[model samples]
Target chain A: MSRTGFQLPLLPGRSPSEPPDTQDRTRALEAKGASEQVGARVRRLFGGSFHLRHVDAGSCNACESELKALANPYYDLHRLGIFIEPSPRHADGLIVTGPITLPMREPLLRTYEAMPEPRLVIAVGTCACTGGIFAGSELVAGPLERLLPVDVYIPGCPPSPLTLLHGLLLALGRVEEARR
Target chain B: MQLTWLWRGLRTGVLTTRYPRRPERMPDGWRGTAVLQRDQCVVEGAPPSCVTVCLPRALSVEETGGDRRLRLDHAACIACGLCVAACPRGALSISNEFELAASSRARLISEHRPKGDRAA
Candidate 1:
C-alpha cells in the first residue's frame, strides 16, 4: 500500500460510528477572546510547526473522529506543519472538544496551565462553543470560553475536517475566521 | 509491483479541498445550518411555531425593545430540518453555509426581523 494514497482495505475492524451519549450531553460554554498579540505569539513560537493538545472534556467523540480524519490522505493537516501533541507541556495550542464536565474542569485547567505562554485555546464543536444543547444541564462546567480565553470558536455538532482546518488556521493567524 | 499503487494514485485525483485559499461549499440541497427567511416569516402567535419543533432550543422568540424577533443560534442547531418542515409558511430552510466558525458566541446568533404578520 502506498502511504501517500489512501487505501480502502485498511482498518476493516474499526468500530462503527457511536451514537451521541444522551446522559453525557456535555455541557460547556464559550468564554474569552485572545488579543491580536496572542496570534503574533503563535506565529513566532510555532515558526513552521504547530503542536496541539486535544482535550475531550465531555464529548460524544464525534469531533474526535473528524480530528482523526485530519490525519488521513483527504485532509492531511500534517503537511501544513500542524501536529497533535500528547503532552500539554510541549504544546503551543490546546484544542478542546465537548462540554467541560464537572469532573474534567480541574484537569482541563491544569492542562491549560501546563502549556507554555502564548498558548492558543480553540473551542471545537457546539458544546465547547456555546454549551450547545447541553447548556441547561447541571453536569456541565463548560462552554470552554468560561474556563479559558478561547482564540477560535469552531461551532458544529461536530465540526467537519475542513472546518477544523479553518479553526486551526484561524488560531495560527493564517486565515480569517468566517463569522455567522 | 509498486506500479499498481502508482496507477491507482493516477486514477484518483487530489482529494484535499482548496480550503483556506478558497471557501468550501456544500452541494445544493445539502442540509446544513438552518436560517429563517425573515421576509417570508408569517409569525402569527406570541411565539413562532418553529420554536416548538426545535429540540435543541436553537430557535426562540426574543422580545427586544418593542419588537418581537426570532433568534436562531447556529451552535445549538443540529441541522435536523425539523424547523423547516414544521413551519407552515416555509420560512425556515436549510442553508449550505456551514463554515460557521466564529471568534465569539454572539457572532453565531442572527436575530431575524419579521416582515409580515398573521394576527389572531
Candidate 2:
C-alpha cells in the first residue's frame, strides 16, 4: 500500500520565515487587549500567580479529567503562573468540581475553612455550579454555593480547557465583557 | 537523540493556543451555549419539546399568571444539545459561544417570554 499525497509539504515558505508586511497580529492583539489589562490587574493582586486546591465534591470524573488537562503540555497552566496545590492551607483559590455529595459536604467545608483569608472559590462544571442532572438527588447536597460563597461559576457538562482558563481569569476579575 | 527529531520539533513550532488573544476555535458542529428564540416557538399551540428532552432540567417551562415562559439555567446546562435538537420550531439552538463564566450565579439564569407574549 502507498501513503503518497496524504500530507502537505512542510515549510512551503523560504528558509527562515519573514514577518508579514500586513499588520494582522496587531488586530489580533487588539481584540485580546482587555485580557492583557486583566492579566496586569491579576499580577498586581496575586503577585502574577495564584495557587489552587481542587476538590471533587461529587462528580462523574468528567470535569476532573478536563481540570487535569490544564497541567498538560497543551494548556501548561504553569506558564500562566497558576499552580494546583495539594493542600488547601497553601492554596490561594479553591476549584470545586461536581455536585456536593452528602458525605463530602463536611470535608468540603473543612477544606474551605482551612484556606487562608481573602480566598476565592470557583465552581467548575454544571454539577458543581448548580447540581446539574442530580440537582434533586437525596444523596447530594446541591451546588457548592449553598454551603459556601462561590466567586466564579463555570458552566458545561465538562467545560473545555479554554473555558476553564476563562473561568480562572474571570475569578481574578479579568473578564472583558460582563457576561456570556 | 537524533537530528531529525530536533528538526521535527522546530518545524512543529508553537502548540499553545492564542486563546484570550484570539478566541479558541471550536470544533466543527461544536455545541456550546444554548439559546431560546421565543419568537420562533409556538408555546400556546404545542407543548415545549425542549423541556421534556432536557435531562438536566436546565430548560423549564413555567406558568406565571396564565402566561407560560421558558427559563434557561446556564449552571445546570451540560451543553448536551438534546433540547436544541428537540425543538420543532427551531426555537432552541446551540450557539458558538463558550464563555459562560460569571461571578454571580444569578447572572447565568435567563428567561424568555412565550411565543404568545411580547418578548422582554
Candidate 3:
C-alpha cells in the first residue's frame, strides 16, 4: 500500500490508500525481516581479518570471472583485508555464485555445513539470491537461501567486480554510507 | 588514481569490439563453428577421423563412392578443437568468423565444401 522508496508496483487488487490495519498486516508478511544493519556489526570488527571462499554450483562462468576480477590490479579487493580462501575451514565467509543446480545441492549443503560457527554467507548475483533467470527450472534446486542463511545479497545478473567488492565491504560493515 | 584510470581507459578501448555494424575479424584459433566438407572425405570405408575425433559428436560422414559427404551439427559442437586436429587432408580448419546469429537455430549449421570440390 505504501509506495515510499520501493520501485516495484504493489500487487493487483491492493489499493494504495488501504486501511492502516490492512497495511500493517501486509507489511508484516512482505517484510524481509531485519538484517544486522551494515554498520553496527562491522564497527566492532573493523580492520579485522576476513577470508572468503567462493563456490560455483552451476553457473555460466560469468559470475566466477567477475569474482576473480576482484583480485585484479584495478580492483584489488585483497587490499581491503579480504582474502579468498580455497577451503571452508580457512574461510570466515562464503561467496556463492550461480543458480544451485540439483547435483550441486548436496555439495553446497556440505560446504556450508563444514564452515564453523560465526561464519557468513554472501549470495552474489541474481542466480544465488533469487535464482535469476533459472529460478523455476527443473534442474535448479536453489536460490542459496533455501538451504542456508544468507547474510548479504548482491543483486545483479553477474555483478561487476566493483559491485561485488562493495557488497563484501557492506557485509563486513566497512561501507556504512548509502553511496550507491 | 589518475594513472590507474588512464590505464583502464586505454585497456577498455583496446578490448572493445567493433561489432554488429562493422564486421569483426576473429582472432587466430577462434572457433567460429564447424563446417562440413564433403569432398575431402574418404568413402572407401576408411575411418573419418574428423567425425571420430569430434568431442561433441557434431561431425558425421555419409559414404557414397569415392567421395564422402560430411554433416556438421553446430548445436552439438562444443568447439573443442579435436575435429580440426583429426582432419588429415587439411580440409577442416577452425574459422574465425563468429557472427552466427540467425532467426532459426538450423541456420547455425554450416554446410560448406572444401575449395575446388565439385561433389559438394
Q: Which candidate is the best by lDDT?
A: 1
Residue-wise C-alpha lDDT for candidate 2, range A1-180, written one tens digit per residue: 356846433332312223322332443334233334434556684565778999998889999999889888888888777889999998778889989888777677678668775577889999998898888887887677666667788998899887898898776665553454
- Residue-level lDDT tens digits of model 2 in B1-120: 699999998999989866666677777667777877767866544457788888889888777676777789987887789987887688778876777788777889888775446543
Candidate topping DockQ:
1
* Candidate 1 residue lDDT tens string, A1-180: 587787333222222232223312221222122435455654775545788999999999999999999999877888777899999998888999999888787678778767876677889988888788789688888777766777778877778787788778877678876644
Q: Candidate 1's residue-wise lDDT over B4-118, tens digit each?
A: 9999989997888667777777789875689877778856566667898888788888775657678899878878898998898898898877666776678878887665422
| Proportion of native contacts present in model 3 | 0.00
> Which residue pairs in candidate 1 have backbone atoms (N, alpha carbon, C) closer than 3 angstroms, thus clashing?
A28-A142, A28-A143, A29-A142, A29-A143, A29-A144, A30-A143, A30-A145, A31-A145, A31-A146
Q: Would candidate 3 be rated incorrect, acceptable, medium or high by CAPRI criteria?
A: incorrect
Error of 3 at A88 (Å): 0.2
Q: Enumerate the chain B TM-scores of all models.
A: 0.82, 0.80, 0.62
Candidate 3 lDDT for residue A17: 32
Q: Candidate 1 falls in which docking quality class?
A: acceptable
Clashing pairs in 2: none
lDDT of 2 at A144: 78
Q: What lDDT does the true structure give each of the candidates?
A: 0.76, 0.75, 0.61
TM-score for the first chain in candidate 1 comes to: 0.76
